[model samples]
Target: MNLRPLRPTDLARLVELNDAAYPAVPITPPEEMTALLGQADFTFGVVDETDSLLGFLIGLRPGADYASENYRYFDSRGADFLYVDRIVIDATVRGAGLGRMLYDAVFALARDEARAEIDCEVNLDPPNPQSLAFHDRLGFRRVGEQETKNGTVTVALLAALL
Candidate 1:
């Protein structure tokens, strides 16, 4: 698989992957995604030999002038972190280590930036056991939990020290 920076052309497939992997997460329209592509601290895709996208990730640095409840929670704590907003892989390619590759790239970026940690959140109310286990295997520990969407959904906020 080839891992590379995300391109404008990749957004549609990315939306499909995101919806499939994380239906609970808010859907981003193409126009919004286009803006985010330029604003995000890091965004990348994993593709096959034919250049078909298999997965993608989006991340933001601390203090970014954006509004995601999870991100704002991290910022409010005054932590220097690289916050992974989302990472989604196509169901067909699950367990192919594409997720790990994306995470390793994020880790490298965090280390390079001298950030204190890598932060992300996993679904809890509408539980995703596989994702929880995966993050545990990656050495992320749950630091906190909170409800969003007017207590409709809860997420376990996780972090791995760099």
Candidate 2:
């Protein structure tokens, strides 16, 4: 698979992969995704030669217009951070290191921008142990946690220094 900037044409497939990730992330509609992508400071996807998106990461810099509780949660902690609004690896490609590769790209970009750290969250209420473990292996630590979606969902906020 190759990493590249995501295209508008990839939105449909992106949404499908995103929905499949479910409460691990969130089920965002294509329209909502388009809005988020527009606000994204960085975006990347892993794809095969056919250009089918196998995994992706959407990132926002400090002070983005996005209103996600998770994003705002990080802002309250501090600035000079790259907030990973969402990341989703296709079910078939979950264990292939595409997620880590995308995160490595984020770390590189953050260093280029002279950012302080990377911030993201994994489900707690929904219990995504694999995701938490993956982030842990990537040197992320649990910074905090919050309940969103009217408290139906809770997440463990994670951060890693560049």
Candidate 3:
């Protein structure tokens, strides 16, 4: 597998993958995705030998103006952090270590930026056990939980020291 910066052409496929993997997360229309890609501190894709997108990650630095409540919450804490806004891998490549690759990249970015932690949230209401376990394995601990989308969804906030 190969990893590279996400491209404009990859948006449609990335959206499809996101919808498949994380239906609970808000769906981003293409124009909004374009804006998000521009705002992201790190946006990258994992690809096959032929460069078909297998997975993607989008993360933001502290103080990004984009308005996910979880992200804003982290920003409000007045701590420097790299927040993982979203990550999605195609089901076909679920066990292929692509998620780890994306996370390792994020970790490296956190270290390079001298950030204190890497922050992300996992669904608690919908209960994604696999993701919870994966984050646990990566040394992330649940720091808190919040009801978002006006209480329609609840997520466990997680953080890993850099």
> By TM-score, who's the top model here?
2
Instruction: Show pairs that collide, candidate 3.
Output: none
lDDT for 42 in candidate 1 is 92
Lowest summed lDDT across 10 adjacent residues in model 1 is found at 18-27
lDDT of 2 by residue, 76-144 (tens): 876689999888999987899999999999999999999989999999998999999999999999988
* All-Cα superposition RMSD per candidate: 1.3, 0.9, 1.1
Please, what are the lDDT tens digits per residue for candidate 3 over residues 1-162? 988999989989977887777654568778888888999988879999999999999999887888899998888888789999998889988988999999999998888889999999999988888889999999999988999988988999999987
The segments of candidate 1 whose C-alpha lies over 4 angstroms from its true place after superposition are none
Please provide, for model 1 over 28-104, each residue's C-alpha lDDT reduced to its tens digit, 9 standing for 90 to 100: 77788787777888987999999999988899988898777888888888989999988888899889899999999
Off by over 4 Å in 3: none
Assess the local accuracy of residue 110 in candidate 3 as a C-alpha lDDT between 0 and 100: 86
Error of 2 at 137 (Å): 0.3
Order of candidate numbers by TM-score, starting with the best:
2, 3, 1
- Model 3 lDDT, residue 153, Cα: 86
The whole-model lDDT of each prediction reads: 0.87, 0.91, 0.88
lDDT of predicted model 3: 0.88
Q: Rank the candidates by lDDT, best first.
A: 2, 3, 1
